[model samples]
Target: MRSTFDFQPLFRSTIGFDRMLDTLESASRVTSIDTWPPYDIVRTSEDDYRISMAVAGLTEADLTITQEQNMLLVAGQKSEQDEASGQYLHRGIAARAFRRRFELADHVKVVSANLVNGLLTIDLKRELPEEMKPRRIAIAAGEALPKAMTKQIEAEKQAA
Candidate 1:
């Protein structure tokens, strides 16, 4: 079973959210479900995050992490090696190539990545620019306006 949604109504009401809505619609329509190399996303702090993936039988050389714009790509490619000829009773380990993508919020950046004990941990932090941060605006109490504002006000009064 599949379902679809109409975003035309939302388009008229929302502003600067087309990309997010498009992402949601595309994700809903995706038919393939790939869950290999399971990963976990955790918020370590207010602006810090961590992603841990269970990548058994994979080494540092077999994995690649890249960050482009607001997207994070993690891919793993196993090196070609000759396997033992002996027949095994049971083969449980998975050593396959995979590519995973993660969407990042604005200002979020990858800090570091480390692989230890078959686990890959990626750390991220959100560092908002000074202009984007919330600032306190001081209120004037019965004081004269600045020269620029006073001049503009006088000009407007004269024009009127």
Candidate 2:
């Protein structure tokens, strides 16, 4: 007797995203074991996205944001003086070293980033080509036909 696993389908079905499967697979491997510096991802528009990280103790000079290949990297490291003088009875804020990466889609570009009230906001916008934009086409009637066809049409019009 054959095992139950033998009845499984040979090939799985994909909706339409064959290329995105690799991205999805890679994303699944990212285990959420580190939650020191929390972040949020928000979709502002159809092609606009924003990433906000709660970096209260991190200054602009301490943070670095860059795009390498297709990944957006955000890292930070506090100054040595700040680490030495800052004394806390119960320290909960993250001020050591950290790096976070986000995968970007094709043609998606980072517009800008700003730090306000201890929150860092990174904006991204996708720029599509002009040929990819939607267009409309108008159909024209055969109103301005040649005289030969016009004569045949007149003869048929007369016959009718």
Candidate 3:
């Protein structure tokens, strides 16, 4: 059974969250999603992550990984002739075309990808800009003086 949710009231006052809300709504209706090529998302550090997908029969040539804005897309397709030439009694391996999209947070970017022992490991890193990072504000000696003290000093200077 699918449950319907009303997000109108919840998102009425939100800004810059349209895509995020849409993604959440779409994810709730998960009946249409394909479960092939199981994957794992691991956090290596505070800012680094890795996505490992099991793609036993696929090569780097057969897979395509694309990053558009905050969307990470991974897709795979096998040739029809390859399937026609071989017939298996019990085909356990899946070479079917599949597309998977991951919604990345802001500043997240793909670092590297490699196929090792049938595992497609994709490394990702979240790089925060300098302006967004925490910075220390150096206190100026004169700036720290109270306004009343500075006014008194100015008055004293004028009298002198």
Candidate 4:
């Protein structure tokens, strides 16, 4: 037995759906991607965010964080160690090199990075330009008014 799927009707009914198709393709591709050094992304404020990754047994000197072309890349490689004479019975820790990439939005800047308690924390802040912020406009009357009245109005507006 075989099952057939039909998407033409659904696709035709949707409006401005190019983005939807692109998102679907991306999602399908990401599922097969590898997941290592598990991470967490949190929004601390309206324009502030933090990304934490579990990097046990990894030191600051071994890790590298960089932002290139709107993408944040974190990579780590352990240093070579002296040969051990005795054989270990059990070795559970991971010391392998890892490279993790994160897609960042525009205007997002990496503020700082710190390693504490086997975790790597990276802070990011989004800075919007002055023109992007909301502002209030003062409406003036079309007819000419007295100079004293205009001065008084300007002073009151400034005080407000």
TM-score per candidate: 0.79, 0.70, 0.79, 0.68
Ranking by TM-score: 1, 3, 2, 4
* Superposed model 1: Cα runs more than 4 Å off: 82-89, 142-160
Model 3 per-residue lDDT tens digits across residues 30-61: 47757888999999999999999998888888
Evaluate all candidate structures by whole-model CA lDDT and list the values in order.
0.90, 0.81, 0.88, 0.82
Any idea what lDDT model 1 has?
0.90
| lDDT tens per residue, model 2, 1-160 | 5322321232256455654776655655647677757999999999999999999988899999999767899999888888778578988776779888888888889999999988999999999898987889888876776566343344444554
Candidate 1's displacement at residue 95, Å, is 0.8
Task: Please give the lDDT score at residue 148 for candidate 2.
Answer: 67
**Candidate 1's residue-wise lDDT over 3-122, tens digit each?**
788787999999999988988887778478899999999999999999999998888999999999999999998777623455768879887799999999989999999999999999
Best by lDDT: 1
lDDT leaderboard ranking: 1, 3, 4, 2
Q: Where in model 2 is the C-alpha error above 4 Å? A: 1-19, 30-32, 86-88, 143-160
